[model samples]
Target: MIDSQSNNNHFISESGYLSSILRAPVYEVVQITPLQKMEKISLRFNNIILAKREDMQPVHSFKLRGAYSMISQLSIEEKKRGIVTASAGNHGQGVAFSAKKLGIKSLIVMPVVTTKIKIDAVHRMGGETYLFGSNFDESNKKAIEIAKKNNYIFIPPFDHPSIIAGQGTIAMELLQQDAHIDRIFVPVGGGGLVAGIIVFIKQLMPHIQVIGVEAEDSACLKAALLKGKPVSLSCVGLFAEGVAVKKIGLETFRLCKKYLDDIITVNNDSICSAIKDLFEDVRAISEPSGALALAGMKKYICKKKIKGEKLAHIVSGANVNFHSLRYISERCELGEKQEILLAVMIPEKKGSFLDFCKKIGKKIITELSYRYFHKENACILIGISLANRLNEKKKIIDNLIINKYKVIDLSKDEMAKLHIRYMIGGYPSKNILERLFSFEFPESPLALLKFLKNVSTYWNISLFHYRNYGTDYGRVLTAFHTTKNSPKFEECLNNLGYRFHEETNNPAFCFFLKK
Candidate 1:
C-alpha cells in the first residue's frame, strides 16, 4: 500500500499550497481506473495513444475522488453538521456518493435545467436535492445561502486543497501505470482536474508535457491564462454543460498558469467527434466535456504534425444524459469530416439535376434539397459523404466550380448546420418583407408564446426554427415580415430585452432564406 503521508512529504515543497494537496485520502471510495491503450487511434495518429479511464470510477467520473477526499478529511464535528454543494451534474453525484459512504448528510443544489439522469443519480445516492436557478452560477449562490443558513460545511466543487489533491491521485496512478508517457491531455472546467494532474507531473516528471483542453464556447481557463485573471464570460454555450463554467477558480487558475504546457479549445463538433471516437475504441460513450481532452489532442497533433510520441488523454466522465445523444449523433459525422455540406447552383432546366449528379460522380449523397423558382437558375443544398481525405472535399468543390456551378462551403458554417440545413425550401417571395433574428430565452414551456406576445402582433411570422439541447437557454431562429427598418425596430427590440442577433443580411440567411 502506498503511504499517502510519505508521498506528500517526498514530493511536496515547503510551500503550503503545494504540500496541502500532495495526496488525497480518496482510496476508500475511488479506484485507480485502468490506463487503456487506444490501439486504433494510435495506429491512425502514428503515436502511442493511451486513455485514463476515470469514467469507470464508481460515480463514472473523476469527481468522486475529490468529493470523497474533501469530505473524509473533515473533523467529526463538521461531518455531523453535514455538507452542501452545487454542481452542473457529475460533482453532485460525487458528493452524494461520498456523503453516503461517510454517513454524512448532504444537500446538492443544481440548476433547474440539469438533466433528469444526473438529478436522479444524486437522489439515488442519498443526497437531498434542491433545484434552483438557471445555471451553475445561480445554483452555486443558492447552495452558499443554504450552507450559511444551516451552518453546514460548504464543499466547493473544484477549488479546495483536498479536492485538488484527490484529483491529483490520478497522476500518481498514471505515472505508475505508464512511465513512457510523453504528453498528458486533460479537460478543464474550473481547472481542478488539470491543476491536480499538473501539480504532480510538474514536480515529479517535469519533462512530461501537460496540456489542458476546454470547450471553445466555455474556455474559462484559456481566457484566464490570456487575461492573467479570471473573467466572467458574457455567455457560455451549454452543449458541454459539465464544463460550462464561465469563470475559473482562483487557485485553479494560478496552478494552471504555472504548470500547464499548453491550453487548447475545441468546438462542439470536434467534441462530438471525439465522443464517437471513444465509443468506437472502447464502446464507451463520453459526455461532451469528457471527450474534450481527446478533441484537443487530435487538433494539437494535427497542427504540430507530431507523430510516434506516446500521449495520454483523461476520459474524465461518462454520465451523459441519454436524450442528448440524438444531437451528438447527428453532429458527429460532420465533426469527423465524414459529412460535407455544399451549396450548388444549377441551370433551372430539364436534366440539369442529372448533370449535377454526374459532376458529383460516385460520391455518397447524404442530403439533397433543390427547389426551382427562377426560370433560368436553381440552387440546391447537398450533403455528401467523403471516403477519402478531407482534402478531397476541396477537389470536389473546385471541380463543381470549374463546371460553372456556384458552390459555397457550408460545412464550417454554424448557421447552416444548426438551422438552415433542415429548413431548406421555398424560394424568395416578392414584397414579403422578410427579416431574420436569433433569440435566446429561458428553456421553459410557453417561452415561445411569451416571446411572440412581446413582439408586435402586426408582423406575420414568416420563418421559425427552435431546438432544445436540454440546457438553461433555448435558441430560436425566427423571421418576421416587417418594413420598419428605422430606429423603431431597434427601439421595439430594446424594449423586449431579449438577447437577439439580426440575421437579416447574414450570408447564410441570404443564401438559404431570402431572395
Candidate 2:
C-alpha cells in the first residue's frame, strides 16, 4: 500500500502524490481563495505580511478542497456504497457539501459538544449527523464502527492521500500568488493543512520556511514531532475547539516530521490578539484556530527581530459562533499587553477610594469592582489600560507602589485572569460564622444584587463571588455569616426562592475558605 512513508526520499514534485494533487477534481466544489496582503499587520511587523483567505470558500473553510478531492476520486462502487466520517466542524461540512453534490449518502459522527452552529451547517449541506462522545477521537471511533458494519467507505479526515493532495492545492495557489514568500505559517490540527502545504512547498520552492503553529493547549503536532510518533494527549484546550484533537493522524504526522521546518505554540491570548489583528488589517474576523498561524508568526518575528521579509499565514476558517466574540474581545487587549489586571487594597473608609483613583491618574480603567463589608481594609479588582509600550505597565505599577497602594500584578497570571479575578473575596479573616451557599439564580439585572441585598440585611455577607457562564441561570458561590440567624434569614431565602445548596461541610470550601 502507498503511504507518505514510501515517499521518504523523493521530493513531493517527483512523488506520485504530487501528480494526484495536480489532477485533483476539487475545482467543481472548491474556490481558489485569494492571497491578499495585510497592510496594517505588515507595517506592525516591518514585513510584507499576507493572509491566504481559506475562510472565503463556500463552506467558509479549506476542508471542502480535501473532502471533494477525496470523494471525487473514489471508485463508482465505493460511491454507491456511501461514505462515513467524523469531524469537529469544518471537515463535516466539507464532506456533507461534497456528498450532496456527488449524489452520495454520507453519515457524519460529531462530538456531542460540537457547536450547534456547526452541526446545523452540516445538516444544511445534506449530511446525516450523529452526536456521540465528547471529542473527535470518540466520534471518529463511532464513525469507523458504522462504516465497517454497513460496508461503507470510511473517509479519514486527514490521514489519506486524496485529502492531503486536496489540501495541498492551497500551497499551489500560494506559490502562484506570491513566489517570493519568506515563510508560510500554517495552523496544525490533525495536521492535514500543514502537511499538504509542506508537501507542495518543499518540492518546488524549498527555500521558503514552513512553520507549524498550534494552540499551546493542544499541540499534538509538536508533541508527535518531539517523540518521533503520535501520542494521545490526556486533555486538550477547548478555547480553539476547531484544532483540539487528542492525537495527530499517522500519515499527517509522518509527512510533517519529514517536511516541516519548525513548529511553534502560542497561548490563547496570543490567538485572541491575532483575531483582533485580522479584523484591523482585513476587516475580517477569524475563528481562534484560523488566527493561530498569524499569532505564531508574530511571536517568531518579535523574538527573532526578523525584518523586511514576506510572510504568509493560512487563515483557516471563519466559523466562529457569535456568542464567543465577547470572550475573544475581552482577552485580546490582555494578549496585546494593552491591559493589565491588578488587585489593589485601600482603606474601607470615605475618601480612600477617591485617593486610590487619584493615584491611578488619567489612565483609563477597563474594569473595577468593590463591595464594602464594614472591614478596616478592602480589596478591589481593577483593569488598567495602557498605551501599547512595554514599559507603560511597569511605570504605572511603580507609581502605585510608591504611593503605598498595596497591589498584586495579575497580568501574567492565567488562573488569576480566568477564574480568580471573578472570585475576588479571597480568604476571609473574620471570626463570624459562615455558611457557604451555591445558588443557581436567574441571570438578569439586579437578580444577584437583590439576592445579596436581602441576605445582607439579616446577616453580614462574609463572602460573595459570581461569574456568568453564558447560561440562562447564573451560578453564585457565596457565604453568609449565619452566627446570629434571626427570623429574617429564613424570610430572605423564601423571598428569593432560587435553587441553592448549602455547603457548610464541603471539603473544598473547608480547605480553601473556612477560617
TM-score on alpha carbons, each prediction: 0.93, 0.83
Query: Cα deviation in Å at residue 331, candidate 1?
Result: 1.5
Q: How close is candidate 1 to the true structure, as a TM-score?
A: 0.93
Over 347-381, each residue of candidate 2 has an lDDT whose tens digit, in order, gives: 88889999999988999999987766447877788
Q: Which ten residues in a row have the lowest lDDT in candidate 2?
A: 1-10
Cα lDDT, model 2, residue 55:
92
RMSD of 1: 3.6
Strongest candidate by lDDT: 1
**CA error at residue 147 for candidate 2, angstroms:** 0.7
Residue pairs with backbone atoms closer than 3 Å in model 2 (clashes): none
**Which candidate wins on TM-score?**
1
